[model samples]
Target: MWHAVKTLNAHNGYVCALIAKVARYSVSAALRKESVALVYKSHGDPMQVLKLQKLNLPALGDSEVLIKMLAAPINPADINMVQGTYAVLPELPAVGGNEGVGQVLEVGGHVTSFRPGDWVIPRDAGLGTWRKELVLKEHALLRVPSDIPLACAATLSVNPCTAIRMLSDFENLQPGNSVIQNAANSGVGQAVIQIAATKGIKTINVVRNRPNFQTLTEYLQSLGADYVITEESLRKPEMKDIFKNIPHPRLALNCVGGKSATEMLRHLQHGGTMVTYGGMAKQPVTAPVSSLIFKNVKLCGFWMTQWKRDHEHEMGELNEMISSLCSLIRQGKLKAPAYTEVPITDYKTALENAMKPFSSSKQILVM
Candidate 1:
């Protein structure tokens, strides 16, 4: 009886050891598969609504690719989207960013367009770019060259793309032709300057008068702005003096609506075009009656998101634009805007800084 009892105890100990090993393996597997994202359950102030939580990524499908995000920037549009004031809104409990660059970590069996180690950006907006990792359909992302700077790659989609499209689609601007734009220090505005300079199309940039106005002007000039003037200067009688050096602008880009836009209209050459891509002042674009009726100045708007959706069937144009911009960056003719890098763990501070007025440096979230 004593030997039988000892044998029973030994069997029970061995079973317990096996159970313990299996439990350890399960926990290790769970730890190996992890993902976290900055999510908002409801729409309101981003600071209050945005929360970081663990996410359960779906298993890779036959046409999907797994990506690990590298970096994303906080643009005013992102803040507006988070505040529920943007034109397009994602479904509830959505991620906070619309732009970023990521590297392909894995691809499904039938995914032919991308391979592991390739870099990509969302082909369209609202892909929820703030997460550390995600699995997406192969068609939803576009490959970007890995040779460019991470900052440039992360920010390439929206601002630069918008700038190029507006410059190309609106008018047939040629060398020596001038483009006037308000909010000239903006990301898109800076891109417009560099691209226009490359084509020898002059840019007359208008920025708000700041305490460091001269310094800002010099910086913009360094980026290829042909002329940098203050918003107040646009109303002055001497504003016509700018035309003496360069012809009255044939293209006017208005990100600032209302009075600034009206003043910009006064300087456009008869029959010029003004493309409104943003409303930074939260005001309506007002065209002077005379300018529209007599000058025949055209007032129009361009939304990059809508353009992408409309061109969904034709991706070749999008790919060509991205390639051209990347080439310009490689040649040092185009550059990323000034930025401040913040870790994903410290997102609140970055959001706050991004919301501050006159905050010149772009806040980029780095994973």
Candidate 2:
């Protein structure tokens, strides 16, 4: 009898092994024949370092999901990262994008959290998004609503989240209160205007003077900017009259540093808060001592990556924020920046376009 029982157990183990092998082969068969990536062995000029590689999709591991890239933005941070100047650098031979939207193609047998056909974004930055496909652990992804605009979902995580956090986290702002920001035509700036507009908060926007300055101003105003002015226009004495019509700005979001940031600081009301998120100007932020001492203006900095790192414990709250942002998009309250899409094969053109001077729209890589 003991021999019979041992034989039965061995037979069951053999059957289980056969099932596992068959499942593995099924998954392998399910994946596409080819995959591609934009990879760099070392940081330097992105246009110089990034190259396309064609390869077969590796076997998916337990708790892993294979994703096909949908769209990824060419953000300023992406540019800086390739230059090896950003605060965080991936290990050598890394993928080049930090954020993007992707769809699950296949999942490992052990991955229960996601399935084929779900839309997701990297849970944090540095996921190497500029590619045709990637294999990532299911936990590294955050599911987003698949029904909304593809562009909105693709670009949702960074610029919009920064705008939302700066709007809510910094000051005790109420409806009817005013917010001011430079680089108002930027993705984050446009998000700030639309979000603040949704909340009935007024926005005083600043942008650089360009050949199409008036057209851009009109565009932003349509996005709910209470007022829009050029950086040079802001520094002019005429701003005194401009201030007469609107309440002094209570909060300032600074992306352009140098003289532009200094001017944004100067326009802040007494006890206002200035949050610096970027320095596209590539210059140091300057402020007069009197403004810091007498007016009691507060200067703070925000890095979206660091914010995510610090608040890793608040995932539920993060989900709530993400849901709210998605809802805003579904309702058309929040609009994604204008995007020019490039096929993965045309990445060279996309990078060059993003590097253009005063380029009118954002560039996104689409699979």
Q: Residue 360 in model 2: shift from native, Å?
A: 1.6
Native-vs-model 1 lDDT? 0.84
Candidate 2 lDDT by residue in tens digits, 103-177: 999998998878789999887777678878877777678889899988899899999999999999989888988
What's the true lDDT of residue 339 in model 1? 93
How many pairs of residues collide in each model? 0, 0
Per residue, candidate 1 scores C-alpha lDDT tens digits across 282-302 of 788888688889999999999
TM-score against truth, every candidate: 0.90, 0.89
Q: Report every candidate's CA lDDT.
A: 0.84, 0.82
After superposition, which runs of candidate 1 have C-alpha atoms over 4 Å from their true positions? Answer: 1-32
**Alpha-carbon RMSD to native, per candidate:** 14.6, 11.8
Best by TM-score: 1
Candidate 1's TM-score reads 0.90
